[model samples]
Every structure is written in structure tokens, then in C-alpha cells.
Target chain A: MQESNARVGAPDWLEEIRWNADGLVPAIAQDAVTGDILMMAWMNAESLRLTAEEGQAVYWSRSRGKLWRKGETSGHQQVISEIRLDCDEDVILLKVEQKGGIACHTGRRSCFYRRLEGGQWASVDPVLRNPEAIYGKKQGGSNHE
Target chain B: MQESNARVGAPDWLEEIRWNADGLVPAIAQDAVTGDILMMAWMNAESLRLTAEEGQAVYWSRSRGKLWRKGETSGHQQVISEIRLDCDEDVILLKVEQKGGIACHTGRRSCFYRRLEGGQWASVDPVLRNPEAIYGKKQGGSNHE
Candidate 1:
């Protein structure tokens, strides 16, 4: 959508978003230093508010139906350096300082590790560390929702 | 979610994704050259498959409930150079060559032009072009769904 440089005068910034029927908006986490997109997840108003207040990444876990604080489980927390809202206001961008240098639960630098090559998805990035070491044995399964 | 370097052997690559209840997944578009995240949009299986086959971005508009071909209206089409799926098989990333050097309907180079500053969102980027000229006066409204 075409927009002028928006002057957001709303007292309640979270209310300005065009949230979906589920009261959620897509949030993308990008490395503040490298500009590498770490991951994408959903956030409700509560999670969005918490992220701003806490200066950390907090997302709504659709599957768990609760707030998913980044790095809470794996100790890989994302320290929020800046937050951005798209021109459309349906998407949020978190410029973060990824604490562990690993944003993917798969134990990689970023979640986007599989690139489509020759009509097939290939692992273009190596596993930086073992998943078992990151999530522990029982919770080692990757679930980035 | 922790995962191995996924070996996507499924005949139907689309089936591997964990689509939301609305059968939509979020797709991120990044500038292949600069790694600047241009925008984020939703895609159903149909749009995702079309993107792969057509080598361009085709998203599903939740507001309009139809397929949206990038640049169809604005001549700012995204020529995708690479597509990456997240480790959890939930999110899709498009590394693209953004046409006209503009990815935002706001006439900016990227949709993420607003930055959080002192609890307020401020427009930090300049509008590179005029939206009315890109989308015509009648279609000048920005809608990046």
C-alpha cells in the first residue's frame, strides 16, 4: 500500500496495528549487526507489548497458545535493539542482538538454512552446533512456530 | 525448534509446511544483493507453488482472498533468485532482486521504514519515488498483504 511518511500520534502504539482475526501479527527477527533475518513468528498484542517493555523478543506461540519469549528455553535470547513496524502495520521487525549467535532451534545461525536448489531443498548452511546440546535430549526436536 | 539439516524428499514440497488453520504461511522477501528485508506477505500452497514455477512472488491476500502477483499493479515486481524454507518448515524466505529499487508501496526502498525511537515509531527512511506515479492516482493506496 502507498503511504506517506507516517506520523504515528497514537498514544497506544500497539493498537495501531492491523491485527488478524486471531489478534496476531507476523514478527520478523533480524540480526541488528549483520542484517541477517533470524526467524519469523507471530505476536499478539500482549507479546508485542512485552517485547517493547522488556527490550527482548517475545512472541505468541500459536501451537502452545502462550507467550514464547525468545531464548527462554534454549538460553539463546534475543536482546531487542530496535523495533520496526511495516508501512502496512501488519508486520513487525525486531532488530535484535541474538545472545548466543544462534537463532535457529536447529542449532544454526538462522532458521532459514534450507535453500531451494535445482528444484530441491538443500541444506546450504551447516549445523553450527548439535540440536541435542541446545534443547537437551527430550526437547531437542525443532519447533520454531 | 531443533532440527537436522532437513532432507526434503517429499514429492510434494508444499505438503511439508505446517500451514496455519487458514492454510497460509508467511513469506519474507529480502534483497538478494544487499540482504535488506523488503517485505513480508502471506502465501497459500497455490501461491507458493506458483512462485516456484514462475520464479516470482505470488502471495495470498487475506483482505482480498485472492492471489497477488508482486508488481502486478505497481511494476515493482520481485524477481526471486532464491527461496528458503525455515528449519521448522513453517516460514518461507524469498531472496529476490526487487524491481525499480522499491519494495514498499510507500515509495520507499523497503517496507520497514519506521524505527522505534524512545517509545515512538519514527519514519527514518526517505520515500524514493512517488506512489501515485507508481500505482496511478486511483490505486495509490499501500496494501502490502
Candidate 2:
């Protein structure tokens, strides 16, 4: 099936994205060359369209009720390498180029800021800076800490 | 801000995380040693519960309306070695041990499946296999392709 489909059209696996009851699918971003799982975001049709068309990783913000362009303010945008829909077409694989230091607004390279040590969740590193400082806005910066 | 709060009660950052609009925050996961991003997911109160207790990456599944263990079904569980909460305490960082060959369920090593070639979004590489083949039953496997 994959062989025949890979030849004529998009990969046969593109059909696997499972959109779920909602029109949204979970998208996982990773550093394409390094293979790091950077972050996850939601992608509806519109967000997906913008990401694919403009080659930017666009996401649907559940909190703000709109589309979000990664690094829009902080210059931490994710450059699109590819966008793969899962077998069910519900999830997406966003290969991105996150510029600057951290893709997360909170001043960390990534958003996860907890580590498990001796069975306890512990803070491993300090935040680099406030998102507002870099982004120059309150809500536009997603981090509150 | 960080010093005064550390002397007494909950750090100001921790307080900030508790009050997030959606009662949840973004968490980032990276390879502990290699620093490769494994994946990103959402964490609410309950999602945090499972992640801390289980020592792996857990996420809130909006579609399922429940908590999801990253690799319980797929054997790709992210074993966290360290965690950090940003100053706003809203974002989290996880240094984890990614189980299995790839962290992504879509058969890529990670979720960023597409790469930009020239100016078009392209499938960067062949999927390792149908997710069904590796994860086996229960995850809605799709090795059929």
C-alpha cells in the first residue's frame, strides 16, 4: 500500500492523522537536525494552512481563541521543514527552526522546567529571563513565572 | 523576587503557575544527555499528577478529556531525569530518557516530520514503520500502509 501510494500521491501514511472529535490535532515540534522534541501545540485547519502555506509553525491557541505564530514577538519563530499528518490526520509533526535561544517564552530553552530526582519533581535550572522583557507585551508572552 | 519568596512560603513563581487562566501550562521535554527535544504536550493539574508520580511524560488529552502517558501504549514513554519551572512558574522543562527507537508515534524519531526543501514543505524522511507495527495493538495502530 505504501509503495503504490508513495509513487502516485502523498505518502499512504498521510491518511493516518486521526482528527479526534474536535477538529484539532496535537502537534509535536522537534529540532529537525538534532531530533529534540521541542514543544506541542494544537493545529486546526486554519493553523495548519498557515503553517504549510507560509512555512511557519502556526498553532491554535486554546486560551486566546486565535491562531499563534511561534516566536511572533520574541523572534523565536519555528521555520517549517515539514508538516506530517499522523495516520489518522489528527496530529501533526512540525519540523521547525526555532531561532534565538529558547522557543518557550519563559526564558528557558524549552517549556518543561521540572526534573525528577530521588522520586521528587525538582527544578533543575533557572529561567533565563521574562518573556515580557523579550516580547515586550504581557499576554503575548505566555509565561507568567 | 526569587530570593524573598524562597525564604518563606511558596515561591512567587509557583504561585503564578497556580493561577494560569486555564489552570495549566506548557511543558518542554528534551533529551537529558543529547539535548534533543523529545516532544511537547500540555499539562494541567491532573496531567502533572501522573507525570510526577509515574516518572514519565504525561499530558492532558483535550480530545479524550483525560491524561495520556506518552509511551504507555507505544512504549515510547519519556523518563524524566530533571525538571525546571520558569520564574513565572508557568512553563516547565523536562530532561528525559526517551524509550523506544523514536519518540514520535508517526514513525519519525521525533514529531518534526517535514523539512523545507527549496520552498516547499516536504516529507523529510520515510517513517520508520507503521506505528501499529511498533506499538502493537491498542494505540489505533496503522502499519497497514
Candidate 3:
């Protein structure tokens, strides 16, 4: 199956990713144009492959031990423009055009909404929408976290 | 000691970070001014504390099972300007001034220097210095991967 994927235009470079002991690599999603980091998630080999093939963000949910397509429940899918690997091949970066202008489970543009200020973490960014409105009552919690 | 730190104005928010089952959290280092993500590393409680106290990047070396002070070897220290936690508290973001203008041990401005292109991982950025020059004969390989 892996060989068939490579034959079907899947890049062999995926095999070069140096996954950690747990078979996971840290993947960061960044706004393609603004460079604002949207979020970070773990990606296993299968998730990375599917993400590349699907041109969307797919992450490995360690807590659930399953594949998770970003914004699957929130309708804020990330449209990947480019994928990058760190020099050490352990980290992945996705340049994405975020749909719905929301990326955080909190319904914020980015998960990184709080900033450290005066020895305190202050929520400096506004919540774009209440998460309850986005995910409904099933807004149990974030799988990526 | 922990109490003394709190008395000295250390915010208790650090304790709120939701580490993974492995007691590690993903931390992304971004160029404070440019907003370019320089690298990603893991941090444990101790490393996170030390980084906050020292105003530099400190990481937990999963492979070595020891704390690593960034730039301790390559003189490419990440002087942190601010540290932010994601809403979910599972990730950290550091706004840093990358010392020496190099963040990657491979002598690149950022560890994320390679981009996916034409079914291959292409090195799209220039190396500012050779790894040999940065770490001498001990350019032993990146601890990141």
C-alpha cells in the first residue's frame, strides 16, 4: 500500500520525516500570508500523507488515537498552500489559508490569543465567535490539545 | 523554592499549562519582530521555568532526557521577548529575538527552511553559516530530530 502511494505521485520524502519515539511529529499551522501561527498538532505518517494528498490539515489525535481532519466539526478548515519540514525533519509547518476566519476551538482567529504581559497571561485577542455556536453542544473539547 | 518564585512575582499560570501525558509541551519560537516561526521544541516544567527566569529558550531534550539551553552550543540563542500559551494550554509560543540571526543548527535563519515542491523536499533557503563552522568538529547532529 505504501509503495502504491509512492507510485501514485506521493512524494518519497514523507518517509524521510524523523518521527519521534511515539511515531509523531509536531506540526504547526501558520497563516500563509500573515504568518500568524494558527495552531499546533501532532501528525503521524498516515496523517501527514493524507494531509498532503487532501490539501487540508489532518492531525493525529494522541488522546483519541485517531486521525482528525482540522475544522471537521467547526467548519474552519485549513487550506494548505505549502508544507515544510524543519532541518531536523522532526517538525512540520503548514502554510494555510484558514477558512471562516477562525482557527481556535475558542472561536478565535488563532489559538495563540493570550499574551504574557506584566507577569500575567492576558487574553488580548477577541473571540470571533462563541465556540458553543460553532460546534454546538458537541463542542466537547479540542482533540488537538 | 516554588513559593519563593511566586513571591518574587512569578505568575502561577505556568502551573496551568496542560502538559501531555509525557509531561511535555510543544513550544514554538517565533521571531518577535518578523513573526517568522524559527523553530519548535519541547519543554518540561523545569525547562519552562528556567526559560522564564533566564529570558532565553530552554527545552527538554526528549532523547537525552536532560534540559537543553538553546544557543548553549552554537551561540544562536533565542532571547525570548514574550511567552504565550494557547487557549487550550497544551502548547506554548515564544516570541524571541534569535541571536546571531540563525536559529537552525544547519545555519539557516529558521529550522523550517525546506519546502515541499515537485514531490520532493527542496531546500529553499540559504545557509548563513556551515554547520561545521557553528559547532566545530562536534556538529554532532541536531538534538531536535
Candidate 4:
């Protein structure tokens, strides 16, 4: 499939990416409308391909060493509007419509909630919802931490 | 310095980070005023500490195996306004004012100027300034490619 696509000079999409030595690239998810950055994750070729085909966020979980469909458990899937590659071709930008409004496993709008203030890290953004309510107590506690 | 700070229960800032196996973390630079993501890079503990101390972006270049002060050569320094950490404590975000209004080595405002269109990565953003003008002939051609 890749060979045929490359020959046609078509979207041999994955071929152009400058994957790291581990064959992975960092993917950042941004809100299409608000332009707020939601989260950052890693993706392998397979997951990237699947994301394009599926029109959603799919990442490779390094810890689990497996494919992770965002919001599969929590139902907070991201609907992709656009996929962008950086000038370096080493990173990916996913302009997505975050479904649940809450992108962080901590039930915050974004994962980046702690800001450095007065020589310490402080929670600048409030948690929109409780993790226990979103993922259930059994899984919520350890979901994204 | 680190020992004293830790003992005082003060900003033992770097200790809370979950650096990768290589003792590095992914850092994202975002435009403080416009909220645009300018670039992404890797940072070691020392670089992160220096960034906090200097109020500028300092990244650890994997290819060069050394520290990289943003704009040290190109004069496009990013003055950091805020430092944020993700909920997982893995990723770092810098809200910065990009000097000269250019962040990419390609002389664009952002490194992520390429957008995926019709199965191809297309340059969506124009070159705000010519690289040759910025870095000169010998250095410009190969600066960020």
C-alpha cells in the first residue's frame, strides 16, 4: 500500500514524517474553534493512519505499549478538523473539536492547569468536573496520572 | 542550590517533573498574546531551570547533545511570561512573547506552518521574513531543515 501510494506521488502520508528513533512522533491536540491546546500525546504510524481514517484522535500509549483511542473509556473523543505537520516534519498538530469540553483526565478543560507562580506550581485552571464522575472511581483515580 | 531549595520545601521545581528515560521532557512554546503554539522542543532539567531563571526559552538539542538558547543566533528570543505544567506532570508549556514575530527557523511566525491538505503537507503560512535575510547565506539554507 505504501509503495503504491509513494509511486503515485499521492498521500503516502506517513512516509513524510520524521519519526524519532523509536518510530514515534509527538502529537498536540488543539481546539479548532477556541484554539486552546488540549493535550499532547505520542503516535506511531499505525495510530496516525488510523486517526486519519477514523477522523478522531488515536495515540500510542508508551506506558501500555498499545494503541489508545482518546476518550474510549471516558467518552471524551476528539473530532479532528485538520491535521498539520510542522516545518521540521517531526511533530503533528491535530485541530480538533473536543467532544466533552473536558480534555484532561483530571476533568479540567486542558491538561495544562498548573502554572508556575511565586516560585511554586499552582493550579491556575479549575477542574470542570470530577474525575470520579467522568471515569468512575475505580478507573478515574489512576486514569491519566 | 537544588539541595537547599528542596530542604526548604520551596521551589524544588524540577523534582516534580516526570522526565523521560533520557531525563528530558517535552516543552511547548505558545504565543502569550495570540495564544498560538510557536514551537516544541525537548528540555533537560538544567535547561528548564535556566529557562526559569532567565525568563527565556532554553532547550536541550538532542541532535547537538547540548543546550540551545532560543534566538541566541537568530535574535528571535522568546521572553517567557508564564510556565505551566500538565496534569500528568510530563509536559511543560511556556507562554512567551516571540521577538521579531518569528519563531520558526524557516522565518515563519511558527514552526507549524505546514497544513495537511488533500493528502499532502502544504505550506499554509507565508514566510514572514526570508531565512537568508535572517541567518545569512551560509547559515540560512541549512538552519532548521
Docking class of 1: medium
Cα lDDT tens digits for candidate 1, A1-145: 1011121332468767888777788899999988898998888877887898899998888778778898998899999998999998889999999998999888899999999887688899888888889888887455556
lDDT of 4 at B41: 90
What tens digits encode model 2's per-residue C-alpha lDDT throughout B65-104? 5667787667777887766664445556677888875777
* Most accurate candidate by TM-score: 4
lDDT of 3 at A4: 37
By summed lDDT, which 10 consecutive residues of candidate 1 chain A come out lowest? A1-10
Q: List the residue pairs that clash in candidate 1.
A: A1-B142, A1-B143, A2-B141, A2-B142, A142-B1, A142-B2, A143-B1
Q: Stretches of candidate 1 above 4 Å error?
A: A1-11, B1-11
Give me the candidate number with maximum DockQ: 3
Binned by DockQ into CAPRI classes (incorrect, acceptable, medium, high), candidate 4 is medium
Where is the poorest 10-residue window by lDDT in model 1 chain B?
B1-10
lDDT, model 4, position B58: 91
Model 2 over residues A1-145: C-alpha lDDT tens digits? 1223222443333334444345566677767777655566676666666686788888877667777888776778889866654333445667677787576666776555455455445665556777668867654535211
- For model 4, residues A5-93, the per-residue Cα lDDT tens digits are 32243347678997877778899998989878888988878878888889999988877777889999889999989998887788999
What is each candidate's DockQ, to 2 decimals?
0.59, 0.22, 0.72, 0.67
Q: Which stretches of candidate 2 lie over 4 Å from their true place?
A: A1-16, A33-36, A117-123, A137-145, B1-80, B83-145
**lDDT of model 3, residue B90:** 82
Cα deviation in Å at residue B20, candidate 2? 13
Per-residue C-alpha lDDT of model 4 across residues B42-82, encoded as one tens digit per residue: 88888888899899999887777778898988999999999
